[model samples]
Target: MSKVTPSNIEIIEIPKIEDPRGNLAVIEKEVLPYQVKRVYYLYDVPSSAYRGGHAHKEQLECLIAVSGSFEVVVDDGASKQKITLNKPNKGLLIPTGIWRELENFSSGAVCLVLASEVFDEDDYIRDYKQFLDFKNQ
Candidate 1:
């Protein structure tokens, strides 16, 4: 088994450029405080449920609720942290080796994730005990 160290979560505010029609925020690859290699969006989620029951060995990610609100639960083998994301311009950064679970998603909520790497099964740490063992090594 492997021990796990949760990544530091930072709240980044996306600069909104105001316009007559509405507002816009452009997220660039490296300009987003961290380099981004993959982008994904989640929607149509039910209530009292959860997602992301695993940890990434090397993948760093930022999550933002573009439409509504949601809760991100992160565990670091020894401790746990919970973050609420609601604003479209605010995002939570999850570093590697942290087990994360996403829950309490509002009906019309849209979650956008910016990842540091592409899809790789080898990067995922699914077992909590294994995560703890890995971190202790």
Candidate 2:
């Protein structure tokens, strides 16, 4: 796999359909760069809390704010960038080998994550120093 960088993270715009009742957005494996294998979400985060302080060795993910907003900080050993997710129809594509942190969540914010692989503890780079070492390798 290629090294993931802050500049390579893509913002994907999901298709939205307007209706009298409610708005709907569609996300499918066919529309993304990788096939979806797992899905999860984060909600009810404390105002002072943060999440996601690691990188994946092989897993790729798309993070979407289903409700409210939050900031995602991504790092690639050398540089970092902050991205805000406020729309349900937009997602941030996080490739492998890039460290990420989620913070500054608004009330009622729901972060939905679509992953490219199944849950595997060995695939996670949870330590910052280890992540840097892995990135250098």
Candidate 3:
């Protein structure tokens, strides 16, 4: 697998179909660099609450704000960037070995995550110091 860096984080545009009633956006594997193995969503988050303060060792993820909006801060030990997710048709691809933090969630914001791996506790680095050590090595 290619190494993930702060500069490599990509914003993908999902296909959208408009209708009078509502709009629909489709997410497929063709638009992503990895095949998705898991899907999850975060909702009902309090405005003061923050999520995802960890880094994955092997899992890659695509995060989308399917409703409302939020901000994602990504770090690669040496560099960091903040990305805003306010549209349903856009996704941010986060690869392995990058630390991430979610913050600034608007009311009723929903974050949809598409993961490249199943849930594995060993794949996670929850501490920022440990993440830096891992990256340095």
Strongest candidate by lDDT: 2
Q: lDDT per model, in order?
A: 0.82, 0.91, 0.90
TM-score of 1: 0.88
Q: What RMSD does model 1 have?
A: 4.8
What would the per-residue lDDT of candidate 1 be over residues 1-137, giving only the tens digit for each residue? 12222455677777778899988986765446567889999998987878899988889898889999999988877788788889887778787778889999999989999998999999998888888887788
TM-scores of the models, in the order given: 0.88, 0.94, 0.93
RMSD per model, one decimal: 4.8, 3.1, 3.0
Off by over 4 Å in 1: 1-7
lDDT by residue for model 3 (53-99), tens: 99999999999999999999999899998888999998888878999
lDDT (Cα, tens digit) per residue for candidate 2, span 15-81: 8899999999998656689989999999999868999999999999999999999999999888998
**lDDT: which is higher, 2 or 3?**
2
Candidate 3, overall lDDT? Answer: 0.90
